[model samples]
Target: MAEPSLKRLQYFIALAEHGKFQLAADAVNISQPALSAELKRLEDFVGKPLFHRSPVTKLTAAGEALLPYAKSAVGAAHRFNEYAAAVNTGAPTSISIGTVATFLHRGLPQTITDFSAAHPDILVTTEEATSAAQSDMLLGHDIDIACGHMPLQHPGVICTPAARESFWLCAPTGSPITTIAEAVDSPFVIFRKSASPIYHDTVVGICRTHGFEPQIHHRTASWSAAVEMVAHGLGVSLVPSPVARNYHGDERLIFTRIGTRPNAPQAWITVRREDQSTLIGDLALGLVIASEALADPVAD
Candidate 1:
């Protein structure tokens, strides 16, 4: 029997992971019909029905038997590709990183600089992506490294906790919002809930704990934009303490203790557990080193 293509194998794994054609298509960056056609081709190669396409896609008995071997073949091919890349370069080279905006502005820049300095031979690149997108990209073998918030649970992706961050208040420099309660009447700029539900709810929870719901004046996707809005006197906003300290803003901004429990995203770094490259391990360690400074509390 003729062999199936690697592209088809990847689509097969994506479908198996996601369990829906549309979802799997998005994960693998292919059209749904295209993914379906590729899987059909794979099924034909084995001469058995692979998936029972119904209201819910499920593996037939034949597919159940083929799944493990398909995964093994795909994983072996991925390792060989990485090996080939290294061989062609004659040295360890080219690491692609996926990160969130928060970390891109936080400790990630420093970490990348340090890693690049120490391993000048390796070409490093970073793509800004949401934590959810990072998981998909990692599973698709697009990125060698991922850095984002914690509590991500994706099969075959290994996440390591790097550091914790505290939340702070960023008010207009001349505004009298010295406390969380003081901002009760002031308009607030918060993260849009659809973009980051945890962050949106936490910022709201902080205000509710202070005995008044925030009069939300604006919503933003990133803390960097929230801080900018606050600096321009658009609205008072809560910001992660590390970002408040590390992100340079002009005199228009003032960061203060909001007197609530730290409400920042816990930092995490992710890589495919299947990838056992030492270069990835060393780069992850560098991120850990850079995050150590963020662990120290920033005084109000």
Candidate 2:
């Protein structure tokens, strides 16, 4: 029998992980029948049934034996392709960068445009993702790089300190916000618990520490919508100053200094530290430079 193809090995791995034919097909982005046929062909080559289908799918003795090899084979194949691409220089010339929504207004667009212009041959794709999701993307190789405040602690991932941004209060222009007390009384627009738990918890915890729970009138991921809601007198918010800076010069928005939390979270650029790719390194450096240029805090 001929050696199993890389695609078949990948299907086997995915099926083993998922343990359901249709689910694995969905994950591999192939039709169920196609995935089933491929698995059968692989089993026939191995001369044993790989899976015993029942109420819950069970791996046959041969299947159990091959599971680890399947994973190792797929991972090795992936690394081989990456190595080959690095050597060939004809690999897909693109970079995927992920960041939370707030960064898009000021930080990402210019950085991406500048990088694209400098390296016209390499395509740069921007993805808007939550802080938690960004780490996963970098781990799964779904995105080449990520820009955000949260630290990158994932194994096999490396984080370089990109920039430091102070937190500020967002409200109507000239609105009085002498302290966290006054800020809490206003209509508050907050990021949902899912967006950035650290930031959200910090803000809420600070408010609680100050002796009152904030009255959150709106929760959203859209900074623009939050700004709009704040503009129409809906509520106030505590956001990274860099994001507030983007809305500077707008008559409807006001930014004030937060008396409680002065030091901002460190904005970071996360990537696979082992990444030897020239293009990914260049893009990560560009982000670090851009962040440093935008670090002024609100005047007290």
Candidate 3:
């Protein structure tokens, strides 16, 4: 009989990890019947049953014995791929990044441009993700780096402060709002908590400090959308100073500096702690530091 293939071992590892045939199949991007058939072939090759088909899938004795070997094989294959990628100049090295939408408009574009110039052979891919989702993406290996607000508390993730800026009050151009406290009676357009919990809570907390809960008239998924809603006179909003700067020339909106507060939100770049030494991870860190140096913080 032919030896079991590496693909079969990968399928076995996925099935062992997930413990559900359908889920395992989905994880490996194959159909259920196909996965089942491949597992049967693997069993035949090994001359033992690997799993018991029950309400909860249970690995057979042989399956338990094979688990460690399968995991090692898959891990070795991944490391081999990474090694090949590192040495192969002909193939473009890929780095996947997750970042907030506001960063794309503010300073990230220039940062990407500068990085591209220095490492022309590197391929960069970006996904606009929320601060909450960026941590999960980094942990899952879906993204190599994340750029967003601080306070990522995952064990395997490390966050480095990239920049700091105060929140500004965004209101309609003709509004009489000179201070955040003055907007207490006005309806507010706030960012959805699910997108950036830190920013959302900061806005809410700042409002409460000024003596009232903001009357939220709209909740938007992105900072730009919240600002646009404020521009149309729908409501006022509290936005990061950098995001407000992006609308500096717009006639429909005005940005007001909030008085000195104890807790100003700091932007951060996050990566899997293990990846900090990798080429892509190091480059990402350098790029963020360079971009932050060029940004002028809002005057106190």
Candidate 4:
């Protein structure tokens, strides 16, 4: 037997919803006779009577059984049409983004603001995740794009450098610590390696390069928390310059340039290779451009 057309399924669903022939016809933008004929044809195709044809319209056993399936089919058809329309018009429908907490403070907020203004039709969703988690989310299709440090090199993932954020020495105000070497012996606050391996390694590598390992007295998951620890004299810490610049509390923390560790890690944007032509690509490109424009230059 031939399959039912989407028009027939739509008409059936409308009739089921309205329970009145005239209302159903109007809902489907068809004449009452035309709707009646189509519904009759549908019942014939199903090999059963669909409606009781009484003053109060009601579905028969077969009609009740087919109602849910017809609704699902019609809904799927409508979604397919919407998807096709969006594709033809080059309009983005939705974008799911994942980024590290540090990037959110760095330049991501402005990037999102600008991207939203530019593509208001696209619904944007953002989640804060670590680099590894973001990579996993991207690979699993949980998110369309990600921003974090050193994006993973997976078979269908493409990574691009978005911005560079320099690390700064955060110390309590009035402390004698002027450089990484000065804080070599001081208690150090470090990033939890599990949360941010790149940052942890960078801090450790910097300390090791200075002829001593950091006396790690405290560890935290976020730059803000590390800065807070420093402000409270818990320990000196290394923080990204952007985080320092954007920090809102505890003016007693001093952010100093680490001359020897001037090379900053490249913040990377990652996306699935297949999403390069979609709205995900547009969002990534816009974020990169916006981040570059808003990035603060390191002081000499």
Candidate 5:
């Protein structure tokens, strides 16, 4: 019997994900005819059709049986390739980090540039992930570090005090929001109800404490979209203070304090098993230094 081809396994997995032969072929950088031929070859080798084709794809029992093994085989091949590249070409030491969209405007770009300049041999990749996704990334080793608001508790992670991020009520420029109650009454453009569990709950709790539920006129997953919605007078929003700084001088948006008694939760930098790399250690230290710069001065 002929040995199973790694390429065939990869193609199968892609087909499963995309659920379309032509699309999967495009994704894998091959022609549709080539993809179909390869799938036919694999099916013949195993003496079974892997998929039941239709207007929409559906997996056969054989396909379902093969899927997990295919994923593992593909994953191992990727790991092997990464290891070979890192060993042979001496690729820059790398770290994957996760942060919120808000930091995409404030500190993240500068920090990444400075880190690269200081360590030209190290590669840094940034991913915009929600707090929960960030936690999942760290635990799964998909990322070396995650910089976002505190994620729920996990046993093998170390969370550092990154920064105290705040939230503010934002409205269209020149719109009067002289009263906290007025801010609460306005139609709101809210972040996704699933964005952050704590923040979502906090917003609901705060509204109840204020004796009124916000009139949520729109819900969005994109921060820029939410800001644009506010700017267009679709609704006001409660957004992170760092993001507020970006729109602070915008002629189309106005940001006001969220009451003195209440503030948004802090952001933390969480790391998985810390012994992974020297470069990650350095990056973590630099984040601490940057966080200190942003901190309020406290007298000793």
Candidate 6:
């Protein structure tokens, strides 16, 4: 057996995760033919079939066996490279992050804490902003990175996906709803559009996908407020997995998977294209790791 290059292992992992040659190729920024060839080479190296190719792909037993090891290798390689970058460059005295309210509530704080530990001398600051304001702030160089929900357009800004967040259903306990469609007639609560338009649009869009427009009766100023309103029987809400995971101390609130399962939404970090450097990559990597930590599916 021959050791496969890290690129091939990465391609294997992406194909396994994304479940389609084209989609996985797009995710890893390679052509579909190239991805297919690389995956075939990887299988040849391992001397076993990995994926059962179809419209929707599934991992063969060999692929399942390799998945965890592949992920561990990739993570270790990333950390090594980050460490090398840190050693080769001048460490800045301060770095700042701007993010939407939801992430600030959940993932961003932990990322900041961990990154701060890694470089104890650096001053870290965070601000909560709407998705659009985040982009503007990045362009103005007011913040090193802008973290928010996607469709982050600005030719001068580069958007890197942080993590994919599944939306979970939040409803008051004892409500008759077990599925999102069951709560279609119930009032829906969302973050106010002005404060967090991405969240507001995501909730409305999810309801529309399940065969009706949401009767959005309440718009709260914060992510917690939306969950609080749902807990009080004011309405039901569809929130990202992080918010669902963190704010469940209230026994009146129920957090579970959306029965219809809207496509997972992506959170991204945008930087001014001109500001490419090792420090930005470090910031983005820490955030990606933290946000992905929050991406696990909520238990039923």
Predicted structure with the largest lDDT when compared to the true one = 3
Model 2 lDDT per residue over 211-237, tens place: 889898899765777778888877788
User: Model 2 TM-score?
Assistant: 0.71
- Candidate 3 lDDT, 142-168, residue by residue in tens: 677888875677666677777666678
Off by over 4 Å in 1: 1-4, 10-38, 43-79, 88-92, 247-249, 263-265, 296-300
Candidate 4 residue spans exceeding 4 A from truth: 1-92, 260-266, 294-300
Q: Give per-residue CA lDDT, model 6, range 87-186, as digits (tens).
A: 7895445567888776764478878888888878677888888777776556545577888876567666677776656788888999888788788798
Better of 3 and 5 by TM-score: 3
Q: Which structure is stronger by TM-score: 2 or 6?
A: 2
> Could you estimate the TM-score for every candidate?
0.74, 0.71, 0.75, 0.67, 0.66, 0.63
Per-residue accuracy of model 1 over 160-273 as CA lDDT, tens digit each: 776656678888888887877777788999988877766788778777777889999899887788888888889898877667776546688777765545445467888777
| Candidate number of the best TM-score | 3
Once fitted onto the true fold, the runs of candidate 2 whose alpha carbons sit more than 4 angstroms away are 1-9, 12-20, 26-92, 173-179, 208-211, 259-266, 298-300
CA-only RMSD, every prediction:
5.8, 5.8, 6.3, 13.0, 6.0, 14.8
Candidate 5 residue-wise lDDT, 155-205, digit = tens = 566777665555577789878874447876688887676775555555565
Which parts of model 3 have CA positions greater than 4 angstroms off?
1-89, 261-264, 294-300
Residue pairs with backbone overlap in model 6 = none
The alpha-carbon lDDT assigned to residue 39 of candidate 4 equals 86
Off by over 4 Å in 5: 1-89, 150-153, 261-266, 274-277, 288-292, 295-300
Q: Quick one: ranking by lDDT, best first?
A: 3, 4, 1, 6, 2, 5
lDDT of 1 at 259: 50
Predict model 3's lDDT versus the native.
Answer: 0.79
Error of 4 at 52 (Å): 54
Q: All models: lDDT?
A: 0.77, 0.75, 0.79, 0.78, 0.73, 0.76
Cα-lDDT of candidate 1: 0.77
Which regions of candidate 6 are displaced past 4 Å? 1-92, 298-300
If ranked by TM-score, best first, what sequence of candidates would result? 3, 1, 2, 4, 5, 6
